[model samples]
Target: MSNKTFFSLHGGVNVIGGTKLHLTSGTDELIFDFGATYEPGKGRFDQVLTVRPGRETEDSRAAGVIPNLSYLYSPTPSKHVAVFVSHFHLDHVGMLSYLDPSVPVYLSQPSFNLLRQLEVVGEGIGTHRDLRVFPYGEWIDFGRLKVLPLPVEHDIPGATGFYVKTPEGTLAYTGDFRGHGLHPEVTTAFFARLGELGTNILVSEGTRACEAPRPDAYSESEIGTVIESAVRPGKSAFFMIYNRNIDRIATFARAARSLGRELVLTPATHHLFRTLSPEEYRLARPAVFVTQEFRVKGLPPWIAGLDVPRLTVPDIAREPARFLTELPYANLNELVDLRPDGGSCFIHSDGPPLGEFDPAFRNLKQWLRDFDLALVFARSSGHASPEYLKECVNLANPDILYPVHTANMAAMPTPAHGILAVSQLYQKYYIPGRRG
Candidate 1:
């Protein structure tokens, strides 16, 4: 009888029979991702609507981030359990600001650091949420709730899937993940371990399930060959990509070296490199530091003494005349587009554009055309690809598959079996309390 699985508060799950479990037991209730929904019909991030009283409710109605509660309107402390943040993306962590401060929230360390940086860039305010930042192997105890962070790769840093050990059983919540080869093999190895972890009720992210298979991603070396073959000495390659993907940076740097150009690191990009490990920061050694130092809170963490090539923004040229003459030897393309000037080439390291619609193609072409530059896109995504996404579902073999964080939110269909589509309205769900 204790093995019964009921459909309680199933925001994004499928339940057999009609068993509804209230979201509370003892002093804990497991609140999964409370994502923030942006206002509908708006182009980009217009502004953040505060989650107060009538204003937030009104804003949610107007913006279309429906199913949002007024606040932590729960009447009792023992009724609500701790919140588990799947990943660091704003949508997944959106409602972080509005939750009851007494409720414990958990996130990865890197994600927490990135969140802090983002929050500083955002509303310019600190938080009062009782967040406990844990590493991949550590666990947190919230009375009866036992939680652990399992590492995963995404476009964001410190991305993780969670495993919760409750009195009822062990449930794993995959905030967001992909089975793509884009991530190192270690990523898959981690998931394989999760499979052995005996995930009882799996809640996975099926965001790309319905999307068609993307092209085979190129390795950093193969991409370097493309860059070397494409660019001539007189071209500068410019890149645009997500800041969280540190792997792409290493790829570009190594590729630049193979092409005979000293790896050029932008100031903003340099800080990220400096913060990573030596191997992780392996950017074409005999490597050149285009920027001197990365500053955080007015102090650099630690400056490496490794001898590498380097240049500053002001030193792109000598007397503003022979910018080409000072350009590093080898990989420097004599002819190409995306220039700091006539003899410069660029690589748009920044990743693809996100949100409702991507402007990457349009904006990229426009930027190149605006300066009469030529370019090629060498970018890859952090999400899992189709085949891998399929594999994760197959490996986990859950009863239902749910997807989020994309325009085709509901498009990610379940491969396991039948589907019970949660209505787009009210979206109420119930789950039984875990027997202690």
Candidate 2:
């Protein structure tokens, strides 16, 4: 067998999310992340035009939702293949169910636990397979390649970066990390360790590379402060947040408690909190929102089993000053029943329909406008700032830099002494060995 190691980009090049990176040493193959892109209306399929039920894989491939890698999904596959997930984001793990069950999939213990909970709640895609969970800093051998999973700080818990030692060289893949989130120290330590290991190649994410710095960009702590200040003293407040963003949830919970108001959560968020962190759920003491749908169709078994305080729209509407509730975009119709006061605050905290690009975002704005509610943005991004991204790249100081998961590769900073290779989709590049 040839001693050469090859690298290829199957997805997540020039786009913000759908990242699928493939590396190979002879017959041994490793796929870092097998997720789809997050662009809402740009894709071939939408909410109304859905993919076929049984032909999900086939439909996705035809629609360019996923890469056409037969070896990874076909029945009679070739080569030795394995998948290592960096986090539980849909853009990173959306296509995992489509992969052949014979291949082994690895994830961090926390990610595995959270994924199982998501599956149980019917929010997860694909069926369970050969999922192997590993602790932080443990090395897993894959014949000619060995991988070390390192913890990093992203918006969601259990986020990780990978340090792979291939036959040709060593490379570090930074999987969607930020230095301003709840755990900046973890990100700092991750880069410090990469510098110590002396990587030959660095595959980094530059999600914010092209965007100019904004004055509204606040740290996670700052977001909490902003939330506290934005809500009025004698008015009910509704905030939208990503369900998986436990830190943000904690921030809201803290803010609510400080104001002597009860933090109310959607049933889905309550399920996630109770399942993932029971202690947190207890400390937060949040009340679950009993939606109209839940009342009409009845609560599911998972929700019925939860022993927590519940609140209805009537309860919130009666004493608006006493509660702060979570409002998902899908539950916008509830606003009609709510009939919130004219000056009520609606804080958007990094939830779905994130930007104007998404159709749902416009709909969210329309709903708030119809209710005459004040829309306040209290969001901190999950990706690192451009300056921080450059600092991270310089710290690692790899021999070669491959910038991925960004809209503009030109905007990303290159290592002072390294070559910046603009990678193309499906293009193969030979990996070089470390210098003596």
Candidate 3:
């Protein structure tokens, strides 16, 4: 009972997204990042072949998606169990709604706030009523153990890593993070803290851990410059990007302001901006609102009620250079309305599709071709490359490293520490120097 143990419920040897891990000290337990994995194309279930709401637990078990954790969701959990969400990425927090309200789920303050905003914008899947705020950079006592939440930088806000101090030793869990986003120092500071704590076991994301080290990865600042360079004097600039990426939005806003153009946003995106950083909304050039006629169907009263000035397709078509608007893959139909000038530019800020075989990319390409809009890739990956991953492993200098969040662990370059441990699902591994 004195020993500290870890169980890799998911994301141990596989690249699947539902990263569920259980840590235990005596009778107390904590589940980290209970989310769903990504299924390429359509596997057991998809948007069309949906899981019934009332039977998600049974259906998920049958489909081999989430593991059986009925104990955590029981009317009274036998152990003091709490679930912590790392971030708001769909692959990371998609399954949260299925968790029973009896089990307390925790997330960063900003993430909780953003989740509320997303709910208002109709992006949330189900109700998460038992959710609690997990404060960052502070240690919270859980029985005999103490867990410290450390803020980390990612494409999305409220990303975090955790350090759990048990009687045996400390376990460092690096939630999805990258050093090239808006603030690289956050990661740098996290590495320094890990070194000081002498983290015994490190669970790190190896998203790009298989790729070769290259200097071509652009920092967030570099992305802004690339966007600025592509905006010709009289050509409209429309960017297709991940709407949740706040740093990218800032980059686009900065570039558009420099060009003396106002940034245009869809209702959903504007809601997200206002919820996350109202100050940025004020500092940035006043944005022009546009209704999403097709994607969101109709503009809800919440959107129509806003006092911001509205811009119609006719206004944008008349002076294409006066605005920079976002166009996602789902909303490509807007191209028909804007009828951009021949020289107008379309920046594909979102990287290539998950695989070349994806049909969505093909559709996007055909649309761009038909519209005569040149596609320019002005984007950087949100994950660190393999070489930098090795550097991070060495910097932490943990006693053992378990790499997750990668498709090809076999192709991963070995870290300098030479302590990569191949963890398996459901196997309890006790850290070295266990307490008697």
- lDDT per residue as tens, model 2, 1-436: 7667877888889888889889888889899998878887677888899999988888888876777777778766787999999999888998888888877888998898888788777877566467889889989999899999999999888999999998777988999999998779899889889888988888888999877879889999799789999899888799999988877888888898888899999887878887787777778889889989988887778888767788888888899999999989888899888889899999999999899978888889999999989999999999999889888888888888888889899898978878787868887777763321
lDDT of 2: 0.86
- Per-candidate alpha-carbon RMSD to the true structure: 7.8, 2.2, 2.9
Per-residue lDDT of 288-378 in model 3, one digit per residue for the tens? Answer: 4464562356566667677776776777778898898877776678889888877678887864353355667888888888998877778
- Superposed Cα RMSD, model 1: 7.8
Q: What is the TM-score ranking, best to worst?
A: 2, 3, 1
Question: Compared with the true structure, what per-residue lDDT tens digits does model 1 show for residues 58-98?
Answer: 56435434333433433345444666676665556655555
Tell me the deviation in Å of residue 58 in model 2: 2.4
Q: What does candidate 3 score on TM? A: 0.90
Descending-lDDT candidate ranking: 2, 3, 1
* Best-performing candidate as measured by TM-score: 2
Which regions of candidate 2 fall more than 4 Å away from where they truly are?
Answer: 1-3, 433-436
The residue-level lDDT of candidate 3 at 198 comes to 84
Superposed by TM-score, candidate 1 places the C-alpha of residue 263 at a distance from the truth, in angstroms, of 3.9
